[model samples]
Target: MTEVFDAIVMYQRDHKEKDLMVKMLTRQAGKRMFYVRYGKSKRYQFAAEMQPLSMSTFEGVINTTGLSFINDVKATRPTSFLMTDIVLNAYMTYIMGLIDAAFVDNQPITKWYDLVAEAVTKMEKGLDPQGIANYFEVQLLPVFGIQPTWGQCVICGRRDLPLDFSEKLNGTLCQQHWDTDPYRMHIDNRAVRILSKLAEIDLHLLGSLNLQDKTKQEMARLMDKLYDDQVGIHLRAKSFIQQLTGWQNRMINRQSSAKEDES
Candidate 1:
């Protein structure tokens, strides 16, 4: 029996000479892998539509053999623009990869599916990609039952203290908690306010918020560290960003200069 699913292509890998294995996040079946025969052939080169982040409809058969064979695919929304810009492409790949890793097979995540679909649509429409990514992280974490408490301390439930994002504690830690721990991430007041606003803003308004470059960098760092600790992996796109922005080079140069000054 064949099943039809609405899905977004999460990844694709070469299987054999002309075949490919496709991983898709489906609305009905959840994350699934499908085998495509002769996917590289000239006649069906359009099947390359199975690239990461492309939305499509897939028809395939599920059997007990552990791999499903996809009979046909129709592209519903090709986010080709995401591929046109290098920075956006890197960010999208990282975000999609993180989501793909976070989800388990056969789990129903209709809300996550909607979130990703909405995010992609916004990206295609020229939304600020970085802001969208940060907003998504704030919203996505809670869906996985790992949402961080931003307005108050997770331990004392104190709402009057300033917000400090600590990966060690997994949420905002008050001054009292910080004095005790002494190792929490000291998030500034502006960062806290921005995070709180992001949590409340709708997806459509993501691009409207104008954050300074420094604030965006700080929020990105905090979110990346938080997710890295929770998810047990680092995003490669972050390293790519560091390289593109010359941040790593500057850090290295500063270290060298400090050593020279000591000498």
Candidate 2:
């Protein structure tokens, strides 16, 4: 029986000597692997449609075990920007990796499918991709079996005081209780506030990031620490983003030095 569904191309890799294995997060099913064959000329026929983060429709027989097979592929949405924009591609890659890590195969992923779709749409509409990525991370924490309290202190339940993240407590620790956990993450309050906002904000209503460099750095650091301590999943896609950030910083420094030399 053939089925039709829309999905985001998470990634594809070599399946065999002559075939490719494509993974997609489908609206009808969770993460699925499809076996794609090389064309007559010994080239991948659906290369463009299989690009990571591209929205495509798959006509195939979905299987309960092993790899499903795709009979036809169609572009369900425009993804040229996602394919061409390196920065967006990097962020989306990390986001997709997180989603893949959060759920198991063959699980019903209707909500997750909607979330990924909205995140892509938000990025497409010029929302801050980093912020959207952060939002996805915060929401996925629960799927990773970590439910951090964002509204108030995990210990005292007070929301008025400045807070810091605590992996031991699995949530925020108010300043009043800082001594309770010696290893509490001493991040900027602004960054902590941003995390709380991301945890609660709707993806549909998410707005401009408008975050300063220092705040963004602090937020990213805190998130990396928490995920490392709690989730313990490290992704190469995330490492690639880190490398990209380093390159961007170096490029900015070089341009700044060039301007100083001209002056």
Q: Best candidate, TM-score-wise?
A: 2
- lDDT of model 2, residue 227: 79
Return the TM-score for each candidate structure: 0.79, 0.91
- Superposition error at 219 for model 2 (Å): 0.8
lDDT of 2 by residue, 14-51 (tens): 76677778888989889998877772124666677777
Residue 189 lDDT, candidate 2, scale 0-100: 91
- Which tens-of-lDDT digit does each residue in 1-263 have in candidate 1? 98777888778999889988888777776777878888767787556577777787767785544777777765467677877888788777767776776778767676667777888887777776777778777776775568677767778989787777777667777777887567877767577667767777777556665677677777877887777677556667766865765764588789999999999
What are the RMSD figures for all models against the true structure?
5.2, 2.1
- Of the candidates shown, which would achieve the greatest lDDT relative to the real structure? 2
Per-residue lDDT of 147 in model 2 = 93
For candidate 2, give the lDDT of residue 260.
Answer: 100
